[model samples]
Target: MIEEMGQQSLFNILISLMVLIAVWWSVQSIRFDLFLKDPEGIKAKGFMVVLTLALTYLVTSFILNYLNWSQTLRFLF
Candidate 1:
């Protein structure tokens, strides 16, 4: 049980890291100049990137937890 918990923790960390990298890559690929034509454009872009990363992490974690819970429930039943 302890080993299984550790494995699940590691898997969650890996998934979170992957999601972070993907979000960063997507944010970096965007043409900020075309979208935010202002002196604060870079700041805006950074904020958006952070926001997106946070949201992605939240969603990914939620889905993972839900899946894990469902599997546990199946085993219980």
Candidate 2:
């Protein structure tokens, strides 16, 4: 039981990191130069990091919640 729990935690951690990186990578398509005073500046980079984190939180929450809901639904049968 302990081993299973450890693996589950590790899986969740890895999945979160993957999601975070994916979101960051996908966001690069946007043209930040059109909006920022200095698109390549430190502030622009920091903004991207913050925006990515917010998006990641929202996405991961939905994913984990869906998994939880699906697992619970199994009890209805």
Candidate 3:
């Protein structure tokens, strides 16, 4: 089913969710005192989350051709 949607649409949707997750995760982390001392830590955490999600999507897709869990991100975004 995913293969029928065209790759560019899927790619855009994936990247957008990755970015949104980055923001949400970063805020949650900050709320938990993960970076209590330095205010700048929030920004850093957000960037890391975005990069992590993007890398995760790429690595998972590359290693597992049968996986199609990327759509879960769409609901969250």
Candidate 4:
């Protein structure tokens, strides 16, 4: 169970990083109507989006762990 929780935490962190990177790429490369209309607004929107995702994932994982929902008999070995 401990091992599983560790792996899950690691996986969640990696996914969050990937999401942040994707958000960065989208914000940098795309010029959608909403974004093009206001550069500062677009920047703020992107920051909010990434922040929300990170916070949600962290909160959910914390709740899950607090509830002892970790899997058993799972290890990277």
Q: Please report the candidate that would top lDDT against the real structure.
A: 2
Q: How do all the candidates rank in terms of lDDT, highest first?
A: 2, 1, 4, 3
Model 1 scores a C-alpha lDDT of 0.78
Residue 34 displacement (Å), model 1: 4.4
The list of candidate 1 runs beyond 4 A from truth reads 34-42, 73-77
After superposition, the stretches of candidate 4 with alpha carbons farther than 4 Å from their true spots are 32-77
lDDT values for all models: 0.78, 0.91, 0.58, 0.63
Clashing pairs in 1: none
Task: Please state the error at residue 41 of candidate 2 in Å.
Answer: 1.0
What's each prediction's TM-score?
0.62, 0.87, 0.33, 0.43
- Between prediction 3 and prediction 4, the one with superior lDDT is 4
Model 4 earns a TM-score of 0.43
Worst 10 residues of 2 by lDDT: 7-16
Task: Give the Cα RMSD of candidate 4.
Answer: 7.4
Return the TM-score for candidate 1, rounded to 2 decimals.
0.62
For candidate 2, report its TM-score. Answer: 0.87
Model 2: per-residue Cα lDDT at residue 65? 84
Once fitted onto the true fold, the runs of candidate 2 whose alpha carbons sit more than 4 angstroms away are: none
